[model samples]
Structure formats: structure tokens, C-alpha cells
Target: MSKSLLNHILLLVLLFIGIILSLSLGSVSIPFKEIIKSLLALSVENSTWDYIIVNYRLPKTITAILIGSGLAVSGLLMQTLFRNPLAGPYVLGLSSGASLGVAFLIMGAGLLSGILGEFIFSKWAIILAASGGSLLVMLAVLSTAQRVKDTMTLLIIGLMVASLTSAVVSVLAYFSNSDDLQLYIFWSFGSLGNLSWQEVGILASCWFIGLGFAIFCLKNLNALLLGENYAKSMGVELKSNRILIIVSTSILAGSATAFAGPIAFVGLAVPHLVRQLIPTNDHRILLPSVILGGAILMLICDVIAQLPGNENTLPINAVTSIFGAPVVIWLLLRKRKLNF
Candidate 1:
């Protein structure tokens, strides 16, 4: 086999090993045999081991995989659309938009309860609100994308919108009661442990839809990498392609943020990591590699968050930022001459 194909095979094997290691290395360590038994849906030799693997470890691992794939794909799409290596869903404020929605839900819950007189705000309600908030911001960005000819200007506008959302969230936090404030603070820290099975299903559905759309646009993305005029000459409709990218990216990024509370850096760093590993900009290979790479990185991070040394888990966002920020800095330094 060619070297490139061999490298890909090796990477896949490493990723599989990473997943298995992550599943087995938590505080209540389960043996590799137990993990395999759990995966096969067999009754583990130890019943408690079965619960740990099946209930806690499995869900956490799956969540990391899903969120990682979603964020990485979102990042890749953003980078291609803007032709900026540093572009990511978080940088464009999709996560901030989701954060705004969640903030509103937390602050407004008391008002909602007072108004409805004994009706509690369900998890579904918060999720819907967060999705709505993200959708609104995305629509605004999409509208702005049509009006602005400069890609850099659109990126700046996204940042501005993100700042505006943050300002609004601050105002909400100021007026919020202590209970709500504490809850909001915890949510903002980002955790995979927060997901219910239903929420996971929602995130997964949105991720698949977004990923499918992105896959459809791979040719256009590849063409655009050569620049807009060149893409136009190749019959790639720039406006339609941009719209498709925006929609897909918003859904993928927004859903992850809404459910997981604005986990950071996966989108921005995972694509670059994948490209470095594969040494190709070809979207066909790059896209899937980035997706798998993201899943592996996230699973590893989630395992770290559990922190075997302590009973308490670290925030998922904090762990990602620790890894992601340096990648962003290196990209910036490497491309110092390139314009955003």
C-alpha cells in the first residue's frame, strides 16, 4: 500500500486505541475485558463494572465523540468558507449565541414559573430556547453575509454580534437571583455530564444533518479554496454555497453549544491537527479525518476531565481551552503575514 494509505490506517488504529484507553482509564477503572463485554451487551463478570461501563463511561465517551466530531466539522466548514485557517464556529459567535439562549432560560425560569404559576422549566424548554437563540443569530449572520462583500468584514460582524450577545447575558446575570446565577455559571463552564439521553439524541440528529450538508458541499469547498473567481469559473454558485455552509455550521456549532454549554477549541484546533496528520487539504480525506480526529481528541479530553486523582471532574471547556489555545497561537504565528 502507498505510504499515505498506510498512514491513514495507522491513524485509525491509534484512534481506536485511544478510545479503548479512555473507556478503561477512569477513576473506577474497568478492565479491557469488561469494556469489551459491556460493548457486546453481555453481563459483565462484575455487575457494578457493567453499570460503570454501560451507564456512565459509555455515555460520556459517546458524548465526547459526538461533540468533538460536530465541533471539528463546524471548524473545517468555517475555515474553508472564509479561507482562513484560524476561523472557527466559536470565533464567529455561534457558541456565544447559544450561551445567550441558555442564559435567558436560566434567568427567565423564575419569571416563567411565576407567570405559569407552578410550571417548571423543563430541560427541553431550555434546549429549545437555546436553539432559537442560536438560529436567530445565525439568521442575522446569514443576512449580513449577503450584504457584505468582504469575508473579513463578515467575520468581524460575527464577533460584534457575539459581543452584543455577551453584553446582554451580562445584563441578565446582573438581574438574576443567586440560584439562577450559580446555575448559569456552572453551565457556562461546559460539561459532558449534563446531557440526558434525549438531549444527546437531539445533538446527534443535528450533527448528522449538518455533516451531511457539509459533505454535499465538499466539491464547492474544494473549488473555493482556489479563490472565489476561480470557483465561479468552475460553475460553483458562490452565494448558494455560502448559504449552505452558514446553515450547516450554525446547526452543528449551535446544537453542541446549546446542549453542552459552549465547550471550546475543538472546532478551531481539530481541523488543523487533522491537516497536519494527513498533510493534505483535499476535503474528501481531510473532512472524515478531521471528524474522527475530533472524536478521538474529545474522548481523551473528557477522560481527563474525570481526573482520576480527584472525585470532582474538571470543566470540559477548561480542558479543551488548555489544549486548543496553543494551537490557535501557533496558527497565528505561522500565518503572521496572511490577512484574516
Candidate 2:
């Protein structure tokens, strides 16, 4: 077998192992046998175990898979589009923009219970707010990117945008009641377990559409590796490609931030990690490898967050940053340069 094929198979194996571990090894340990039984629809001695596996564990596992794959793919797109190794979904300020939107709803409007008055939070309202905020930031970034000559300059602009939005959020939080502040704080921590089945369906659908766009842009992406001038010489349409990339990224990153609350590092770190493992620049291969790599990383992080056999869980964002920051640092030290 070819080395790439062998690598693909190994990644698949690792991903399967990750899925099994994620399903069976949480705070309440479910035996591997019980997990298998539950998945197969076989009767288990304890119905509660089955319920926990099917309802809680299953949804969490699916969320991990979807978020991981989506963020990784989105990161890959940004990296390729900008020709910058460190570029990620957040490089365009999408996450901070989403946070700003959510803060407006949760803090500015006092949506949380006991904040100022009795009010129930609506999931759709939050989603729409988050999406709208990120989309607006994306449009602003895209416009600026077109005018910028240097990719690094565009990246710095994104950081500036993120900082500005964060400042806005801070001001909103200061004026908001304590209860509302707490609500926004919890959302900022990020979680993988809060998604309902209906919400999952929406996330999954958006994820697939984003994936479709990525796949369609594979050839354009590969062409871009040779630089924009070379790509245009080969008849690649830069404008259309950029628009598609921005749309795909907005969908993937927006859905993830809206649903899971700006979980970090997966997008920024996963593409670099996958490249280290696969040692290829081919998007066709890198794409699937990144999806698998992201899923496995997310599963491991989720397991760590659960603090196995304990009642308490860590924030997903904290765990990801703790584990991923070192990898990114090491990658930078070794490469000592951006590919672009």
C-alpha cells in the first residue's frame, strides 16, 4: 500500500478509537460492552446507562466530530487563501464578532433569568445574533483584504478588529447586571454538551454545506499555492475563489461559534498538526486528514475536560488552549517562518 493510503487508514483507526473513548469514558464510565450494546439497540441491564449513552454521550460525541471537522476545514481554507500558515477562522475576528453579538443579546438586553426581569432565552435568537455579528465582521474583513497588499497586514487588521469588538463587549459587560455578566461569561467558556438534537441538525447541515464549498474549491486552492500571479496565469478566478472561501468560512465558523461559543485552537492548530502528520500540501489529502485530526484532537480534549470519573468538568476552551498552545509554539519554532 502507498504511504499516504496507509496514513489515511491509520488516521481512520485513530478516529474510531477516539469516538469509542469519547462515548464510554466520561464521568460515569460505561463499559465498552455496554456502549456497543447501546449502539446496537440491544437491551442493557441498566436503562439509565443506555439513556446516558444515547442522549448525552452520543450528542456530545457528534458535536465534537462536527465542530472539529468544521473548524479544521475552515482553518485550512483561511490558511490557503491567505497563504499564511498561522491563519485561522479567528484571524478574521469572527469569534470576537460573534461574542459581541451574543453579548448584545445576553447582556445588553438582560436575557438571562434573574438579570433584571423574568425572561427566557431563545436559542434561535442567540444563533441569529451570533451569525449576524460574525457575518458583518466577515464582510468587513473581506473588503479590507481586497485592498491590502500584504497578507500579514490583513492578519494584523483582523487582530485589531477582534480587539475592538472585545472592547465593546467589555463595555457592555460593565454596564450589565451581575447575572447577565455571569451568563455571558459561561457562554464564553465554551461547551460541547449543550446542543440539542434540533440544534445539532442545524449545525450539521451548515457544516455539510461548508464542506461542499471547500471541496469545490480544492483545485483553486492548489493553484493558489503557486501565488496569485501564477494562479491567474493558469486561469484561476481569484475574485470568485475569495468570495467562496469567505462564505464557507463564515458558515463554518459562524455555526460553530453560535452553537459552541468560540472554542479555540482547533482551527488555528489542527491544520499545522495535520500537515506535520501527513507531510503533504495536497488539499484533497489534507482536507480529510484535517477532518480526522481535528475530530481526534477534540475527542481527546473532551475526555480531558470531563476529568474522568469526576463530577466536575473543565471548560473545553481551557483544555484546548492548554494542549494546543504548546503545539503551535513548537511548530513556529521549528519552521521559523510562514509558508507564504
In TM-score terms, which candidate is top?
2
Best by lDDT: 2
The residue-by-residue lDDT of candidate 1 on 1-340, one tens digit each, is: 8766776787688678767877887777677887898889988889999988777777777778888888999998999888887788776788778888888888877767766553335666667777888898998999988888777788889989999999999999999999999988888888776576666778889988999899999999889889988999999888888889999898888888877778878888888777665777788888888888888888878777888656788888999888667765786588663322
Candidate 2 residue runs with Cα over 4 Å from true position? 110-120, 142-157, 328-340
Candidate 1 displacement at residue 160 in angstroms:
1.4
Candidate 2: deviation at residue 35, Å? Answer: 1.4
What lDDT score belongs to each candidate, Candidate 1 first?
0.82, 0.87
Query: Model 2: per-residue lDDT, tens digit, 116-190?
Result: 343336767777778889988998988986787665677788899999999999999989989989988898999
Estimate TM-scores for all models.
0.91, 0.91
The superposed Cα distance between candidate 2 and the true structure at residue 319, in angstroms, equals: 0.4
